[model samples]
Target: MPRLWTTRLLTALLLALLLLTAACEAEPEPRRYDFAIQLNGGPTGWPVWVEELTFDHTWWSPGGNLGGGFDKRPPSGGATAVLSRPMPAPSSVQARWFSYRTQTFYEIDLELPNTDALLQQWYRDYPPPDYRHYLMAGFSGEGEVYVWWRARCTVCGRDRSRDFHAPIVESAWAEEAEGDPGRYRNRTQEYVNEGVIPSPW
Candidate 1:
């Protein structure tokens, strides 16, 4: 038992060191958001837990139905999740997906393909079996709000596969709101004011 305890402690220490390294070596700046809420499957019964990660991004609002934006659906039928970010550059955008249930993170790369052509290809290639829908509250450096999807390729396994990319369509930022009493309400209003609904991939 003592030996087992020592092994566990060593493993924990190693993991902590890795996370610390990632945090320390980050580039640009970090993005702040409310929570990556899971509206379906295992998260159905549990109250949502919000986690904050450091990244570069802009703040955007939620317009379309969360599930309609991409291919993956929450294990549950109806999923409504809201997250926030400070702002990011406009040159190009990409994202990383983390499966909390599995404790794994996957990187997704996006290429600005023709919107119509990309959508048609997405329908034929990145079918329901391959990709999933994700919502991000992004902030553009110029105070624009953008929302998009992290499409997962079905052909490749999560680790080996290429992240789904979509053409840029809709992007905007939330407008300034007068003083609001409730924090959640204020945040929701912020999302509504600057929120964007990207075309479903």
Candidate 2:
């Protein structure tokens, strides 16, 4: 890894650890709203190959579960999951992705994508009788991760909750990309070196 990105990853990891240590202690209070993660963005022509994907959330929320657990993995399209309660939105993605640019599967801590614009879109979507809050993140050839602040009340006519929180995701949501199989597998092996995920090849 380049020095800059290595530094970025280290710094992000340390910060996330600190936040988790501090925030996990507090009991997450149940709120009026629930949370959701809608994931679907990927490479234009190729299916997204997810190795590992997790949201680095820095807040107190119940179960800290993001989405109904990415029910649909990559190459099969994205999925939506409903979690417990709303807290602050996730700050970044600690994920491993297969890069179409280099044909390399690598991991990094990436910040959320299209945040400012997404917030703008969020504002435009709500504030009448009912509204929703949302945030987003995406990477090159990587799936986009979105967390929604939605209404938990089934009886409520309008989605009154508008605060989003996020993660502790299912890494399996990432799947093998459709490409040169042997090459991709070989490179993945080189990168992983007999780690948690056994090589299918």
Candidate 3:
């Protein structure tokens, strides 16, 4: 009887340990959000024809790219697109433009927004005349949030080519929240405007 009881107790402990291990190994549900991107034609319009648009993020899943056979936008005009996916915000977006005029393809990097209060506010009131006319937005990361933007050029050359930074913004990681935390998680519907690609003449 003593031996039987010991065996039963050991079996019970083993079952409990197995349950605990399974619980620890369980993966959490993925957090989802909407990522919006906008592209403008700049003051002088798009210099090259767009061949493809690609999106890449730091997350583990596969990002996507799109084929573009679209016409060039007129001066001061632009386009907008969005992607809704799980956490791990996009690291960079690129636009591959084919310049029939120049017979070359130019890859333009789109700017991302920083996840900060002041920058978020600035994004809402974007295209501010006094500043450099930058657009900003936010996104969630593994343990942080980020704000990104594309800076506009104050001046352009006669050929419409201007020296400019690809994109720039600030980021703040979450201190309180655990797992994949996004400051904008409460916001189910928000569009991030990935700014314009200038004509590479």
Candidate 4:
């Protein structure tokens, strides 16, 4: 009888340990959002090359995450791109851009905002019908992120080129609860004349 009781106790302990390990190994819930960016401007005679584009972000929970990439494309006659990511918590996203010709870098940081109030205002009346023209939308996680306008030539020595202006727009909105496969409402805003492209070289 003594040996049988000891064996039962060991079996119970092993089961409990397995359950605890499974709970700890489970992945945290994910917060989902949609993002988009648009560039506005006619065109600069000098070639416009995008050497790099990167995104650094922190989620709402304890741990943070990073996403984004580099694109080697010459943006002419305006450009647009859309992306989406799953975040563990309310987060902040930083965007970096490097121009090869001008030898300059541009950066923008956006912190996710309260959705309740912003959504109410968005339903009332969407501000700036042409919000895509502005770069502030990138913060919201959706909408136009930037507009690139070339003022002068940066490559040729004949006429000294002025600093290029690359608008940085950010926009985002909260979807359904974690694990829900449904779309949610969204709102976007633009930052007026906020982006300043400075030359590092």
Please state the error at residue 129 of candidate 1 in Å: 0.9
Residue 35 of model 1, lDDT score: 28
Ranking by lDDT: 2, 1, 3, 4
**Candidate 1 lDDT tens digits, 1-201:** 999999999999999999999998888453321223222212211111122222224332222212122222212223444454322223334443222222222332333323434444554665555555343333221223234444555567646336654325344333322331242343334334543211111
Q: In order, how many clashes per candidate?
A: 20, 5, 9, 20
Cα lDDT tens digits for candidate 4, 105-170? 334455544443433343234322212221112211111133222222334455433222232222
Ten contiguous residues minimizing lDDT sum, candidate 1: 40-49
| Predicted structure with the largest TM-score when compared to the true one | 2
Candidate 1 ranges with C-alpha deviation above 4 Å: 1-117, 133-143, 167-171, 181-201
As a whole number from 0 to 100, the lDDT of residue 98 in candidate 3 is 35
Candidate 3 at residue 169, lDDT? 37
Estimated TM-score for each candidate: 0.29, 0.36, 0.34, 0.31
Give the TM-score (vs. native) of candidate 2.
0.36
Count of backbone collisions within predicted model 4: 20
Query: How well is each residue in 46-124 modelled by candidate 2, as lDDT tens digits?
Result: 2335555566634321121121223232212234444566544455666555643345454555554334344444445
